[model samples]
Target: MRRGAGIGAIRNREMVQAKYKEKGAEMAETQMATLSRQLAQLRTSLESFAAKHGTKIKNDPEFRGQFQAMCSSIGVDPIAYSRGCWSEALGLGEFYYHLGVRIIEVCMTNQKRTGGILPLNELVAQLNATKSSYASEISTDDVQRSIKKLRCLGTGFMLIHLAGGRTLVQSVPGEMSMDKTSVLGLAETHSGQTTMSLCCQEFGWSEDRARTALNQLVQEGMSWVDDADPTGERVYWFPSLFQAVRSSG
Candidate 1:
């Protein structure tokens, strides 16, 4: 009788555990179904909203920027016209394609001058100065999106969010060295100019360490050497600061 009772108890415990496992599996399946319905609803709502505001999204840079942000929040790339279905519904393929070509042209045409790392302001300024097929005015947000699309193609386009409101666009493919990057950051504080002493003073780097970066920039046409500083310390000016200086002037 004792043996029979023990076996019955073990069987009851197994039955309870089996029921719990079945309940958990059913709950998981129901939750997944609910999530799928929510996602489908979200996609439909986005499509409807985009259809209503299609003109503003295509013609106005600021409006387009906001629209892109909305799409991004939901992990949607409606502006990527190269991808099939979104391109047809939004009709923004030509606009982004034109803007992307223009960006590439601007970066390539001026690479010799700015070493392919352009200030976002300068890029926007240049983009607006010309007549683009799709846009009358280009915003930083638009430029950034276009760059993001270009980057997906495995190109070298990159955005650098610098301190303050300044942004940099690197058009080339190579990864910038840490030393060179630090030097550029330091130049941002001193009206786009820095020297070995300033770099050393700010970063506590040795003279040799400073020159290695500054000299490479100078050689790459990114920085212009000015031996005429009144303090007698050689100054390296970043061409990347052109738009900011011009706007202030």
Candidate 2:
């Protein structure tokens, strides 16, 4: 009879512990839901802030430096903050998120130019130009660091090198201009199906830069990923341009 009583006591204790664990799990789930909602609110706020100040931030070297400095002051990595906020709550791929931000910035640059994105070459030119003057203020290391962080956040940028010593940089969808002729003419000739690495080698661009640019192009729909290559190299062949050419022809 005593053994049976002891067994009953053990079973009661187990039931109590199980109840506590179930309550704890419920509390945890509630907290996670609240946190997720808060994160979404934060991302909306950041996106508004970016829309209001992205161009200024991109163009003014001093301002960009000061902004980075300010991020340092607050003990925060601004790029990481921006990217993290998007990734955690939104379930967006980093490349798409970054590309989306870039597209919005381009749209904000001109409302009428909406839907007519800038070409990869022009975008790269702008980035390089900004980098040139901003180089002294912001090191290549910083840019590379930011790039790495952005990639982690799932955002990617592309850098294109063309013949005659020109480099073009652009983000995806937000800035792919349909009207301009790519200096490489690969986009014009191949119908947006050419590999970026091949274009870079043909144009003598740094392999790393070319790869990044090609990836961006693929994301933006200016180019397509080469299924033939197991490694997933991107090729641009003027898919947009060909459509236009077909219409004209």
Clashes of each: 0, 24
Query: All predictions: root-mean-square deviation over Cα?
Result: 2.8, 14.8
Estimate TM-scores for all models: 0.84, 0.33
Candidate 1 deviant stretches above 4 angstroms: 1-11, 81-85, 132-136, 227-232
lDDT per residue for candidate 1 within 103-175, as digits (tens), equals 9999999888787789888898899998647545788887888898898887889887665557788888866
Please list the C-alpha lDDT of all candidates, in the order they appear: 0.81, 0.49
After superposition, which runs of candidate 2 have C-alpha atoms over 4 Å from their true positions? 61-142, 146-249
lDDT winner: 1
What would the C-alpha RMSD of candidate 2 be, to one decimal place?
14.8
Global CA lDDT computed for model 2? 0.49
Q: What does the lDDT read for residue 231 in candidate 2?
A: 67
lDDT of 2 by residue, 95-165 (tens): 23443454436424532321233344343333455434533233332343343454455444444343334
